[model samples]
Target: MASGKHRDNIKQQSKAAAKKSGNSIASRISNSFRNHQQVAVDSLDRLLASISGTLMIWIMIAIAMALPLFLLLFLQNLQQFGSDLDEASQISVFMNTTTEMPRLEQLRDELLGRSEIQNVEIISAETALQEFQASSGFGDILSGLDENPLPPVLLVTPLAQDAAVLQPLLASLQDYPEVDEVQFDLDWLQRLYGILNLAQRLTYMIGLLLALGVALVVGNTIKLAIENRRDEIVVVKLVGGTDAYVSRPFLYTGLWYGAGGGLIACVLILLAQLILQGPVSRLAGLYEGEFALVGLGISGFFMVLLLSAMLGWFGAWLSVLRHLRAIEPG
Candidate 1:
């Protein structure tokens, strides 16, 4: 009976030890989670504690971000306009005035055979002269002439409107023996495309500059916050707090600033789009176009918000890492 009792005590002790170990681990995990939650809460409190100051910084960041975002939206709309213009682009081929009717028919057939030409249309000299007379009010003066002075023309529509493709095709048509001239307003289209590309590059340059400005803004704000809490940081260090522990709250502070600024920037962009929509729509109508302004969709919105927060976090981390080393327990 004594031996049995001894075994019972040993088992009880073993069970108690297991339970205690389990409880210890669980408690540690709970505390770790709680500390993390506390850090976030404290960071939010810090932001709220100085509303006016935080807002000023946020507004600055928003303005910086909005400029680049607006430019990007404008470029996207321009690309749509370019696409519409591409569809309307056409090439005009004027035949030699004295070319035979059979050769003209042959030229038309050759153009139709090429894969690059989408459509071919013939404009005889008689039809052309009649059109000129009807519009120019020179009917009686032109009738006195023995024959029509105008040349037959071919209207060639290409499969592509891009200058590179059209240029080569136009050159090929000009090489035909029956062809007199090939004329296309490709220079105007090329110039428009060049301007659009320049604008896009400029927008990128501006965005990069403004992003740097945002980082500096956040960094300066974090530095001030750190300065304000210098004594608190020193005390924590003296009490055996790890560097990571001391920096966690400040890091959160930066994140709050970045996220808040990004949200404001998005609001500004949306408001701009809303206010300009009617005006833009009317302008498109004036040109007989169905153009509509496009805003950053779901993915884009979240990307802006998340990117802002990341920049803020990065700025804050940089500031903390730089300034914390200077702070030590005396």
Candidate 2:
């Protein structure tokens, strides 16, 4: 009976101990969150006190981020424009002037049946002459001619725009008895591809370099902040403050700097887009095309903000890791 009573007491104690442990953990977590909130607020207040210097840092970061962002946007737009010109990649086949309509149709059908060709459009000599007359302001002169000089043309759009595919197709088309000329100016297309590739590489290189610059800029700023607060950090450590506690405010400072820079960069990009939109639209209109400048939408804006914040945090962490240890209570 005494053993049973002792066992019951032991179980109650065990339950009490477990409850106390859980409460302790919850308390620690809550205190940690509160401490972080206070540190962040203090850091922001300090930055607001030194508004001019903070603004300078933000401007530097903004410029660094904006250049690559603009280049990326330009490259995306250029790629879109290139895709829109898929029809321009077609091969033009001018048939013999004496070729009959039936033979022209037959050749078009044959080309369409091939796996390499996506589509074939045939223009009869009469239709071609009529289009030329309408555009060339030579209707009166053409009417005085003895007979139609234009030949029926076939526009063959290949499934692939690669030079290897196009070259063989051009040769085969030239071999046809009814085809008088086969024209595909591959050089310009190749040049465009090369230019796009070079631009993409340049954008990547510039972005990497600028990203490093941003991190360095934030690191330098954090270093200065640490130096200014050296006495305070030493006092905190002397009072048994942990390294993490001492570094928290500075880390928050770096985050604020990075976030502000990202916001400014976004605003700058938007302003530039607004200024350029009219001119770009006018240019597209001149080419008889409809195009609108695409800016960073909601998702992109949030992504930029998140990236900048992470960079700021990284820079702060790096600075704190390097310098916070060197500052001793003594």
Candidate 3:
């Protein structure tokens, strides 16, 4: 019985050993994954702490980047508004309601002769007043007016996309003996065009300057990271760690800086848009336009994220290459 018990004990010991070995291997693999993930986060923390004024630098860059980016997106909506105006050449002419029908008929015939004219519709004062009443939310009040009072209006549409025709047409119409007034609210369109042009140019300039800020911030951050890990790096190189191995943590550091800054930029832009959206939409509503504030589309968001990550990665890589050689203990 004693010998049988001993044999049983031996068998039990063998099974326990196998389980222990299996657990050890599994634990090692789990630990490796944990270490890999932790390394990146830890490196970022260490790097961030090492860099003096890094937080301030990143915030500054993000704010600068968001400004023009916001303006650019806002102007994109304006461009869409112009698209709605495509079909209507948007020419307005005013004539005295007392003008003879024959003269108005002759004016129409002359307009039809112009090759540059596509479609023309004339609205009489009565029809114009009715339209105004319906849209003004004062339909009941408008009926109490003494008379329609509005003058006869001619609305013109051009055949060509070129808006320059309005100038020549306006000159001719002003000279017409029967014409009282020729008007095109070209001021709004022209002002919008000027603003859009300025936004585009400013966008580029802001982008360049902000990008330089990003590069400088990242570079300085990586430099500080190198200085912080001087002792650890020296020991790492002394212990047969490859250059690649030593560089990994610093590279991750820069990536985190850039990525963090980019994320902040995204949030800032979105927040700013949100804050301004209500007022902007209310103003547009007053003008009879359904102006919905649009944000940075998916592609643009991704590109910005990519640019930020690249900036950080390149900055870290540069720091590692430049400083790591000096960190080796001969």
Give me candidate 1's TM-score against the actual structure: 0.72
Per-residue lDDT, model 2, residue 11, is 83
lDDT of 1 by residue, 156-264 (tens): 9999766678779989999987788998876776788878889999999999899888888888888988999999999999987889899989888888888999999
Q: Please identify model 2 stretches exceeding 4 Å from their true place.
A: 1-27, 79-87, 94-117, 122-154, 158-181, 238-242
What is the model-wide C-alpha lDDT for candidate 3?
0.75
Per-residue alpha-carbon lDDT of candidate 2 for residues 1-330, written as tens digits (9 for 90 to 100): 999999999888967876877756677788799999999998999999999999999999899888999998888888777767755788889999999999988998999999999999999999999999999999999989999999999999999876677779899999998899998876676678679889999999998899888888899889988999999999999987988899999899989988989999999999999999999999999999988888999998998888887788888889999988899976
For candidate 2, list the clashing residue pairs, or say none: none
| Poorest lDDT segment (10 consecutive residues) of candidate 3 | 158-167
Better of 1 and 3 by lDDT: 1
Q: All models: lDDT?
A: 0.87, 0.89, 0.75
Residue-level lDDT of model 3, residues 48-72, one tens digit each, is 6856666775676577667667767
Which stretch of 10 consecutive residues in model 2 shows the poorest summed lDDT? 17-26
Evaluated with lDDT, which candidate comes out highest?
2
